[model samples]
Target: MEELDEDNMNEIKDKHEIGTPEDHLSEIMEEAEKYHPGYGASVMTGDVLIHALEIKTTSFCTLRCKDCTHLIPYTKAPAHMPAEDLMDDIKKIIRVAKVAGLIFMGGEVMIYPQLAELMEAYSKEGFYDRVGFVRVTTNGTVVPSDEFCAAFRKIKNGYVVISDYGILSSNRDEAAKKLESFGIKVNVIPEDLQWRSLGDWHHRDYSKEEAEELYRKCHGKLYLHLYRDHLYHCYRAPVMNEDGLIPHSDGDYLDIGSMSVEDLSRRLPEFLTGLSCTKSCFYCDGFHEQSPFVERAAQL
Candidate 1:
């Protein structure tokens, strides 16, 4: 290959920079229309199926990891989400698609009081059979009660996913053993595994096309979330919205409670793959895995 001069290199790098915010927004709107067509003209729910659905059961976290995607430390006060409302949302979701699994998450899911009850109720409603997997994510801070373990065991493919934060977490091993003793499956994400920053407080500088390319390459794009009765298309949108980092307006998510099942089907693909980037993407680091992995959950 021929060598590129300094000027050529600079020119190539410049191609990636996003223009002014006004211009960027204009580009996004134009591209959204191209891919999604009618842009926000109607509610068209139909045959949209989602693979994994995330439920934030609580916003309380015992450990404050400096780089939490959920922005838990920024929370003014911890709050428990009523399990009844969550069940109602899940009911709305299953009507749209055959979800492969449900991910119960939080600042730390174990801290949620209604966890066992929610798991048992979802299991009784045939969610275990319908989705095939039920995963509860925890930061390894607290040990779960025996009643919780019993409820987890009742699901056909239920498991606990412990984020092993090394020195920061005291009870990881104990919690895993406790669940396994009750015949529940446990999967531990060791401290060594790499977690690429979903954009650490700054968005990647990218042209509209470049941002779309990054969105296509992101695995986390599939990790959709449901909160406050709305269905979001990705993991970042809902949490970042709570942080006041992005507009939580109607354009950001689907109102699952009111939209008809057919309307949801028609709109699902557009939400999933239509947009170039949310305004939040500018505040994020984008999915650059080449960035070195920091120690998991370093204290804030």
Candidate 2:
């Protein structure tokens, strides 16, 4: 892996190099086509690169950290995507625009044993190759067991991104070892202590500010934000709270099933705007929050 330098960090914050959301989507789908050519022309145009599928499996979690967003307590368990529905969507994405990959996320996807089955289904459909990678974001509260290892082994490329909240035992070292033992790459995301500052009104909470700065540094680079049923360009671009979901002007929220790669590619511009809803926004770790990774660079 290449080292991320000041210049690199600046570029990422600027978001300039990321290209328009549409272009980004096209690029990823095209890349996916390298492995699966059966994908449709829309796969070459679909905005899967800029748009990532975020599968929210569960609303409840065992850990309740101080800076936890997703407002787990406030969220309710909707419904899990049935095996058939998920498979159908995966097949469509592969046939249509070749998605870069699927991000299996949740309050805790591991808690649901069916997640392994989900991975196996992708493997069976010959769609795994079309998927650039399969990443799962999890808190290192549970270690990978034999069954979990076997499920992931079916997929050629898989990674586990562990968010270390400083509460897990052994500082998550044991869990990392367990996953690596299964021939899986385990990456640990250092806990962002700055999250603690959010609890204090005057402690210079820089979550959103830093995110903007980081966005600018990345040259206006934007990542896809999939929430509820609609997809927004950036994580903070959409408003989904207890009241209702509001989209930015010129932006429309479409059901995932109704959405085509071309439809998303065409709407890239409207998706990237910084909406008014951001005015009262509270930052979550999902966005750019100061982490130990940043702190280490400062010391150097």
Candidate 3:
């Protein structure tokens, strides 16, 4: 694997300037020779392929829980990603990949100002038709405004995934009620939940074999993140990188905004799935099969 210098990393970040999901879906569909029943396209990244894409809108949340998979609570400063930036990545992904589901999430998804507009864009592109479901994961604490709720109703197939924190959420019921009233399905994650220490939130070293084994057992590895211009195999990388908890390398992610489907298909899986583990793994708790039950949404 080649080492990525700081200059190259910066350049990669600034490279994207074109395309949208709607614009390229037709081209991708042509190249997508195989298709799953509910999943949209059939494209390959090396030998590995995915039917789902996880879209993380922001790292800023309303509550500061101790254990966040996203490592958002540990961020020194969290902010909502610009809606325009997020839409750009979504466009690039839909162009190159066929997806069965799209998970829209954030620090607190309700707080994003463009929540309604984002949903609208996805729907306008007929994104809902391509996937089994389009879900927005939320803490169930913020009751969305009229506009946001309206967007949910309009999408028809959109779902509200609520992580109910029991006593921690003063508005959980209200929020669910509002969403349900709009005829949106509410998927609830009860307060009683399993908790695992993702990591010590510090760096550690591991051999390639060990890291690969860890990745196999890790759940975060399943939900590859599409944020900014990069596609990350694990959701942990961006937040951990932002907090200076892990070193950033080109090997750690794919610059989806810059690379063509041919280029990504040939090279992505080598560094993405071939790696033993990510730099974030050193700081992460690795995996605990029997994650203990803990208080949901307990504050620091």
TM-score of each: 0.77, 0.58, 0.78
Candidate 3 TM-score, true structure as reference: 0.78
Task: Mark the regions of model 1 whose C-alpha exceeds 4 Å error after superposition.
Answer: 1-47, 202-206, 257-263
Give the lDDT of residue 180 in candidate 3.
Answer: 87
State the displacement of the C-alpha of residue 264, model 1, in Å, after optimal TM-score superposition.
Answer: 3.2
lDDT digits (tens) for residues 39-115 of candidate 3: 33333343244444688787778898776767778776677777777777776565555455568898899988888
Regions more than 4 Å wrong, model 2: 1-48, 77-81, 169-171, 192-252, 258-300
Order of models, best TM-score first: 3, 1, 2
Clashes, model 1: 13
The deviation in Å at residue 253 for candidate 2 is 2.6
TM-score of candidate 2 relative to the true fold: 0.58
Q: Per-residue CA lDDT of candidate 2, range 1-300, in tens?
A: 123456645544443243444565576555445433544344344343333555555555556543343444334344444655556555544554434646676666667556777777766777653566567778777775667767776666567878776755233777788778888777787764222111211123556666455444331123443455545444333333321332233233434556676664454335444332232133322332332112211110
Per-residue lDDT of 1-300 in model 1, one digit per residue for the tens? 022354644554443443343454355334334333443232235545455688988888898766566667766556788999888778767765655557899878898999889887877886533463577898888999887888878876667889888867789999999989998878898876534345454445677776666665554456678866677766777667765655445676788767766787777778866867665555555544332334457667
* Best candidate according to lDDT: 1
1 or 3, greater by TM-score: 3
lDDT of each: 0.68, 0.50, 0.66
Error of 3 at 145 (Å): 1.4
- Root-mean-square deviation of candidate 1: 10.8
Off by over 4 Å in 3: 1-51, 260-273, 288-294
